[model samples]
Target: MISGVASESSSQLLPWQQPIWQDLVRRQQQSGLPHALMFTGIAGIGKHELSLRVAHWLLCQNSSGQADGLTESCGHCHSCQLWQAGSHPDFMVCQPEDNSRQIRIDSIRKVNEFLAQTPQISRCQVVVIRPVEVMNTNAANALLKTLEEPAGESFLLLEAERFGSVLPTIRSRCQRIQLLAPSAEQAQQWLQASGVSPDQASQALRYNPQAPLQAQLWLEHNLGEQQQQWLDLFGQWTQGRAPLDKVVAAYTKMELDDVIHWYAGVLADALKLTLSVAEDQLLHGGWLAQLLNACGDGATLNKTKLITLQRNVQEIQGGLLSGAAHHNKQLLNESLLLQWRALLQ
Candidate 1:
């Protein structure tokens, strides 16, 4: 659905899909093409999908190898069909396994072997590596030799979250194609086109369309429901009679890492209340006056909220919360809730 051939059932292509596809089509249409291309960008930005689309285009038998005689393997031909099914003997896609972020040398060796042999079908052998920077030393070494020549017609599509972390030798041999997220407006539009409500689409843009699903789920599930629970607890805490320990325990059970985020949501409501008698509606404008009153009636809450955001970003950058998610991912679930309470206080 991205830049390459789109079928009737293909998923809706995001805003960032067209540029890379068009570039490749143009170059291949013109002359001898880049065999090894490094598609570099942020994680979850659809780089993997982009790589597959290019592979499909390259191996499509229906394609008459472009206008250039230099182009090979027609897109609609038999070789292309095999590539589509991922049954093509010469094509390979490599990546790190679950629980490990680094690509082992063994994986690289396998890729090398796949490329070393002559292409059984198409003239070119396509090897795609996702998150190329995940290659460990031995893996890098194993791939380095193959990358140098990569055989004419051998196309390597390597995707990495960031470019700087990859080996210079590995990068030097390949052409780099940078992929970026579409504009915020574009992301919202894409989601709307996909049938999501405008409100949900707008909410998902908070993080990045690269991860719109994450933003959508967070807002719809966690923030929408759990956030209300938190607001109730916040109210009880402000009442003076509620034991701070019990309230703290409830907060400890809540899932929130960015304490500043939670605070700001409430803090904004407090400000809105003061400026215009918007009435009690803090935290979705519910009990706004109560929240403003709870904050002790001042602009100080805004300043505190901003400071909290700054501090949270710093600590997160330092991996201060790394231990929170260590051991089991669910293990961190508890730790995250506990830490959120402590951090906010």
Candidate 2:
């Protein structure tokens, strides 16, 4: 497990964060802090950021100074200084080890040990764990004991992008806060302010509506161009202009998982269009229509075929993520590509 002390930062809350932050601050002011607080939201929506801010707020020496407006950690105070220096004794964060993504039982045990000790500086001890769903069953079970009977003035802050995937038993013990995405207009404006073009912002938002940071990074990496190139190659292959072997060779040189995901997005859009789903539901939207006009004919857009393709793509993606190397890379790409080609035909 990776352990660290919480630190004070100059980062301000995003627009989507205001509601939840306000509520937490209100609770703190009322002296109604939850011993275990769960912050659940989509990835890249700043759940961890909000959690850290809350930690700093609770640990700040001058927390009472800002009751009228936005509360902040008095960065000049002793407590804030300790936090800034990463030597704060009252705060701790637990995470998965770099080599092993799983948060094992030993890590949770360490947390249990930390909580057992009296607060070193601040009156309350704080612990933060991110993406807590990565914790194995044993680790989670160990954590449940601490949650059931938290000792002293200790607080546990947990963040999960996929909250539903976390154990229900764990969920029941904590006070949950769900963060929703900002409106489309807000997301687009934020992206534009960050120097993304209108079209690029729209494309990225379509890919992941609740994750503006991910969308911005997607545009930064020029994945929109990559998507276009992949679609073009697929179109050519469908028309017998580009050979399957050539496309497979191209894919082998690029990130395999990303390619699969992009294809999955396109297929998903096509399926939605085939079912006459609302236009807003599509990731590609008008771009999908244009692509279909130039390439796809909806001949292979049946629900069963689309679902099967999605499932297969997810399975392959999972395998790749889990370090699947038993099969030859080129051969695997060729097989997947041929399957896609057949579906298109």
Best-matching candidate per lDDT: 2
Highest TM-score model number = 2
Model 2 lDDT tens row, 1-345:
555555455235787788888778887776668799998887777787788888887777777623453376767778778888878888888887755656788888989999999987777888998778778788899999899999898899998876776889999999899888788998998899888789878879887776887787788788778877877777677567888888887777887667777777777777777788887787766655564566645544446766787788777765544332244668877776676656553
When summed lDDT is taken over every stretch of 10 residues in candidate 1, the lowest stretch is 1-10
TM-score of structure candidate 1:
0.66
Clashing pairs in 2: none
TM-score of every candidate: 0.66, 0.81
| lDDT of model 1 at position 189 | 70
lDDT (10s digit) by residue, model 1, range 225-339? 6666776776665544465666666655654454435655555554455456444333354475554456563412344544554454445432322222223324433443343
Residues forming the 10-long window of minimal summed lDDT in candidate 2: 318-327
What RMSD value applies to candidate 1? Answer: 6.8
The clash count for each model shown is 20, 0
Q: Given candidate 2, what's the lDDT at residue 100? A: 66
- Global fold similarity of model 2 (TM-score): 0.81
